[model samples]
Target: MPAPSILSPRDGSNIDPRSLLSSIGEVVYSWDIHSDGLQWGPNAGDVLGRIPEAALNRGLAFAGLVEPGSGRSRYDAIVSSGGHDHGDGVVYRTRYAADLAGRKMWIEDAGRWFAGADGRPATARGVLRLERQVRDGELGAAGNDVCDRTALIERLEQTLGEHLPAERIIVVLIAAIDELTRLNDDFGHEATDEIITEVQDRLRSVMRRRDHLIRYSSNRFAILLTGCPQNQVEMAARRFSKAVGQTAIETGRGIALVSLRIGAAVAPEFSTQAGALIAGAENALAGAKAGASDTAVIARRRQGRETRADEPSLDVQAVAALNERRVRLALQPIVDAGTRQVAFQEALLRVGHGMDGPFFATAELIPLLERRGLVRLFDHRVLELATEFLAADPRLTLSINVSPRSLIDPEWLDAFLGCTRAAPGMSERLIVEVTETATIADPARMAGILKQIKDRGARIAIDDFGAGHTSLRHLRAFPIDILKLDGAFTQNLRRSTDDRFYVRTLIELARHLAVDTVAEWVDDELQATMLCDWGVTYLQGHLVGRAELPQRGDASALLHATG
Candidate 1:
């Protein structure tokens, strides 16, 4: 069925666009940039604070109440406007501080800013949504206490930082309705939506005040338990399972009992990376579903793996390695599954001379380097090495993972941009893979920086796609070219049905967005074939090839192999 036209309803009667939008729970507004006046829809008052009607109507009044340094203001949007786009106006999605009845919150504005006769932004119109409230109402999912995938990533980062490794570990639980499709087939769409909402409420009831419950998928919910011990994860999963599965949910139509399948993985011990951590939980979830009797299953214990004591002068040594040219690029081959040919080689960071030499993996000192603001040097060195390879072999298409810290570093961005600008077609041959786990201060700024790279023809891939905060919305917002499916899914794909379903879902999502997808950790022909059948565009793993050093002149230098 076609959507109702904006000009008139299906009955051919003229309809006010703002009224139509507000009737469906939207707060629409028209702002005159020069006069600082706003014409708001009826629902505007329902979303904003207890301010007087005049204050709410005046654009400056709303601006004054916006959280200071919120970064995205109407004025900023005007200043940063990309002029005019063929007279269609530029669509902008910005988050700003909103005063909501004596409380402060971020509100998301999705609208278009039009250029005036002089080509400066003159008028704007958009929909306003409470950032938190939109996570549900806009997405049409769970409510209040339930967060989205992005918030889950952020909370995980925060929780991981607050709790020391020596203290209790964090537990990530992935719970799904055993067969939600059956419910959809039994009950109608509206009824099923209510059932899922009730299921979320039931799950939230069993969770502690400090824990977080996020809607992971259509039927899956990701629960984050911070400072939870390794031994306590299973108990918590079982408790969650009983809370949802044992009780019957009263939907608008009828009562329905739901069984929750839960899989859990511990943090840092499982993996410090958010994408990897969530992937582990997902792997366990697949395992739980496969096991006939187990409603909840904790991933096999990777726990109790001791972290080596921090070397007192390792930072200094790593710096010395960087300066002395000990740091080298280890190019790993990512192969195309169908042809089994090397599609591109990923440039990995390695610090050492040769085999049996004093070797240092990039991970060991990255946290320290980032904390001390020394990662810029490492990024520069890696880029230097990768660029050298690119210059040497024009035939090579290479990928390099960059830290979020380096993304914000002016010197590094300049150097990277320079490398791409050095020669024609250089950026086209290079793929910048961003580590999803790293914290990016301003994603918009990062997007702008990426746009600079992309405008020069550089490709961008989201490394460990599932583990990070890059959602479908982000995929659109950022100039992303590839979605690298988190390795954890492929690692369990051959044996886990849930992983198979998820891999297909991700591949389909990428396809829908017209973005290519790459599946990592393809350990065998079986996995490769499965991925190929599922429409995965690229595959990378030990099954294809392992990391190797670039071929240099005989006895010229050392072979540096890295992750």
Candidate 2:
């Protein structure tokens, strides 16, 4: 207000005394110099944590506040410089400890000197800011928001400077304020405020004196642990997780437990820059919250070479090589329980290195293809191979397992139909088997897709029918021509009377719906006889035949066994 201070250099001015002051001080500080003992604004008192009158009373003199050894020399240099005309400007830094609210705090004073018209050195005014906070063992009650942020920053810088010189630091923030939301909804705003206040108190108790903790959002709090290594960050995260898990706060009505999902990102791993470090940590936290697990999710910048070890490895090149007409087909006979005559044969897809090696079954190959999103490709190939296999044996009916994903894809459907068209009577002989779990997830969609396949003269069968939560509701909702009961339900029929009863009920239900039923995992002749007695249309398991590639001569053996 007093002639608007102009110690700051003009724009593009060659002189920069501020840079020198910044470099010399432990913390950043700046001042405006003018032609007076100290041309300072009233706000300078606020920066120095003192009243303007009291600060002015102690002005321009080396007091007991400054260290005796260095303080005297600095004062002598300033007085002798009389009027420093190095023309850039006068800048100096002095360290001191000031009594702040009955506690001593280290401060750095940075100021510039200006000359008066009399050619005499005049005012040297600037900021005397707290740079380091010394904490006595007194633990203040929480919810105070009274802690000095600048002092906290200073302490964090000092502590971290000794441990590690991090290029960047990231702090993960995880919090649950569901209790606050529920409180606000039930009670008035007053109760909600109290809950939030309590949450702040709880958070403060867990944090260190140097850590920067802030209300990141209304429901979330953030802690910035400067120079924290990735491992230490993880350890801290786990401790916080355990603490949160153990805490229960009373909200008048009842006690509410808080939950948290933690995510972490390390500096230089995610980013070297401080701002980017914060952002990456936030992203990792989001991922943790999205995942189903309760444990903290730790993430780092994904290196170019990083790969998930848990995911099944697929050799794309090897799979691609086999994509060309290099697949094989096998048929397991589904016999009519009453007649013991071959009713149909379920065609199984197989992959082999060559004619001599062991063949990979449809069960094994299908999962691999699905993981690679190549199920449609494998499905189409199986359909083509089945069509060719069936064409040679015109009287035999063939069932092929189709992955749910493949059946849902419109492109795969068209490709499948095209392959069927190439082999005459292929659609009439084909049966499509889909898993119970896949069907349950989207029953309406599965029904519609299966209807399309049925319209082309192909039969539909539900595989692993009793394996999941498949109830009569599924049967009534979707039209399945065949139900293949899971082995688990039928395997121990003799051991458990309850198992026998459930199997009988399932068989009776299938018969009422006019849906043919097949029993899988019929390990022994005893299981097979029991299943046949229950009126199962077909039976398949170890007793019948293991899945194998079909050869020209195998047809005679299959026919002989069925006959």
Candidate 3:
């Protein structure tokens, strides 16, 4: 066995020669698991002088000398690791503590272990390097588990490096106690440290395993929220503030009440780099201190999502097409489950036919529309068009989608009234669909808008059923006439038992509420059959019939009417 010298490798370097004989700081060893035999490199005795040779020569002796911890055993790391290595052996890295001349030292042990025929680790070769020296109470600052600045950077870097594609946004928080200097002056160092301990403990209690709280300064702590969402940043910061400084902490002098101020920054949004994130949080911290509030202020940086000037704008082209009367509604049919006859048509907005096809669909245009208040404008236009289609034919029913934001538009009521007046019974034939998640912006407003629709003879359908997790009470409040079972539920109907059960429950609930159920995306007989057997009242998808555009100039035949 041989180990290479580490010349103050503050960070692990992959190219570091760790398999050499003249290694200074590292010791290599090979161990036979069954026989408990051990062989050490030349540097082992000199580097590990504190551990007696008797303990070093045997596996059991070394295992016995290791300090107890959740991560103590290298054996567990080797054997418990997943997958086979094709005789190349599995690699593992673990850290553990042992008595070195009666003083505890941490050792980082990295090695590859071979599995025997039984597929269990049989032998291993590894290098052990001194991680750090720890005296009593040296594990953390002031005997608390909060680590120094180094661990924070290391962890943040690791998290960014191994980020999952669908992982929630990462947030960094820099927190400081309000008037900490004044308290320190009054209470002295001993009492002030007690306050820090109390603060650290509170932060730790509120934090999760993935999240880390570090002692950044004498009075400041940096928290890394690994899985925090952008919208929940303020809420989390407020929770932390309450936890740390809500009640009075007792010290030797007296009961002292403290307050915390926190500043936050989101990753890849406010910043992508770890150093920049820390700096951004610190800047926000300064703002919090200047304002002297417990609430956190999130730093906002120029995002990478800004539309480039050189790129042709879709919004501009869409608007131009709308002006040129290039707009059309592609009507998808929703049919009765039993009869397989058209129940109604869900009107989808399509803009401009290009070489590629329509310039954009409603789904693509919606996000851009919502930002510019164009959704409400389109909503009004669609309502007017739906009323015309109903007026032109007596036996027509159409479903139109309305944006949640559109409900708050002052002109929405006027547009609805104009359409209803122009064609009597228009409301009776119209079914308005609202997305489940969109109502989150203002549910009370949604309830009000929904009431307006239901008060008239119009029907209301909540789209994307389970995505919003809306309660039964909410369904009643909105006076829903239909529950559109989101396509997501039925897509996995064959493979997912949970989805099938959920769909059944929803259908039953809708039945209790006297609301009709429409299953969207019924692209196959299996889905249609399953939904029909499950008592779904309506079906809408490619299997039933694909959405067809009204041909060039055949309105009467298209509406199934003639002169």
Candidate 4:
């Protein structure tokens, strides 16, 4: 069988036309146009997915290919524009449905008009191609360009209107493509694209339906959760934290573990407008990422009120006051359990505001100092004060707590050593206390740091032992001089048989290791006797001597008075 030929209109004759359509395998069809109704070529049955005789008998209805009400307007426009013009061409785009073997499919039609001898549009001919799919290579680098821009814009407007007042909505944009650039280099573009798609799906699943999530850049996403209360923003932040923790995407080339550090600011809390909200959140989020893992940090803005943990502080003046020697030092004595003698005094630092009276211990003071980055200044000053007191009373030993941050600083260590050397025979009388929780963060570094302090004739004690997850493994690894069993351990000795057994075991182990032990918060004589019988070397509480500044007499007199 031969294919039919399509010819242009010519001089008047019979305008003979033939129709041929067949569906041997794939359908095929042809059309012939004349002065009257359009004629069909041979194989028209194949194109129309029908028999050749049936296509010729009915003559194809051109309007059937177009959707209802769509092609009609374009058809009228083409007819009103003077049928067809030769030199002038008219292009008409319309969507329509086609019937093929009783099944319907969408087809797009593009028609060109031709002019006649009378200078009026005569006929129009066009090609119809099914809007199915394009080849992957033919789509170029832009791909499907599948984003629904109108849908996105409408969703954003509705979300902002319902969840946020016009004054409070903020949109923040971040560029994280640089992070993916390295991944792309290590893997490939396809692997990077997979990572991006996985991230997009995960974010969408985690976010609320009203929240507007957009892929603003190759690797960055912008999330706008509307109508979020200023105080409850952490609720949304926790969702982000959990999602980042649980969702891990695989690129086949490699696996990319998901992790995120979020920063959030409440509308009207940090800013009144959307732009500021975004900027503040980004600033806070960046800070969170720069710090430790599995953390969501909220941005704090200064606004004359007292700063909460979520809010940024304005305490620069308070920190400066500490450096001006405005902070006071107090001492709390830890006594020997069996001998009922004063063993050492723990130094407490307090910062006062005019007539505000004395504040309590160093635990309260140290956190504020650390937040203000003034821990080193406060530590140095307290060490200087303790050294002076120990020099005047050579028999008294003093304990001072040091932060992990301060312990890591070479300058702070050097300054402390210098103060110890300057004090008249005060080195041997000093005990450095580091908390068990802080030491576990970097055990190797802590061991090295404690070793240096121990070599300088200062005893190292693991403060607040048995309070947390600290195990015997830590006891064996670190070179500690003393183990100050927490008050909880002693408080439970009377009622808890398990606590008694554990404390007794700890005592025996410490004794075997040649490490001294101190039982804290031994309030009554009964608890004191039991702890002493358990072989606790030192006892610290109000039942012994209360912490006080040195008075003119033997310091041991205070211990005798308390007993």
| TM-score of candidate 1 to 2 decimals | 0.45
Give the C-alpha lDDT of model 3: 0.68
- Spell out the clash pairs found in candidate 1: 275-467
Worst 10 residues of 3 by lDDT: 10-19
| Model 3 per-residue lDDT tens digits across residues 421-473 | 66667789899898776655667787887788777788888886654336555
lDDT of each: 0.65, 0.55, 0.68, 0.55
State the displacement of the C-alpha of residue 31, model 1, in Å, after optimal TM-score superposition.
48
lDDT of 2 at 47: 41
On residues 1-563, what C-alpha lDDT tens digit does candidate 4 reach at each position?
Answer: 11122222221121211111011111111222223244332334434545234433432344433323112222322332222221323333333344455544444433444443333334444433344333334323322222222333454455555555556544332212223324554666567667766766676777777566665323444566666665556667667556654756788788876555566666555555555555566555545544543444666685565646774232454465565656655567687776676677787665544324343223233445686677877777777777776776676778888877789989878977787667635778899998777776788888888888877788999876653335555666788899997554565454435455555655665665679999876667877887787788888865775566434334444434544
Enumerate clash totals for all models, in the order shown: 1, 1, 1, 29
* Candidate 2 least-lDDT 10 residues: 27-36
Q: Which lDDT tens digits does candidate 2 get at residues 24-75?
A: 2212112212211223322333444443443344443323333222111223
TM-score of 4: 0.43
1-563 per-residue lDDT for model 1 (tens digits) = 21222222232222232333333334556677757778765556555647766668887666655543332355443333333432324544445555566766656454566554344556666556554432223332223444434566787877777774657578888887765545654664457667767777888888898888877333568888888878777788888878877768877778887888787878767777676777677767655654643555666655565646774366787788777777766666777657666778887776763332345533335556777888889889988877777777677788888888788778888898788788778778889888654423566787887888788898988886653244444567788888898664565564445456555766666666678888876767888888887778888876776655555521112212221
All-Cα superposition RMSD per candidate: 17.6, 30.9, 28.7, 34.8
Superposition error at 275 for model 3 (Å): 25
Better of 2 and 3 by lDDT: 3
Q: Rank candidates by TM-score, best first.
A: 3, 1, 2, 4
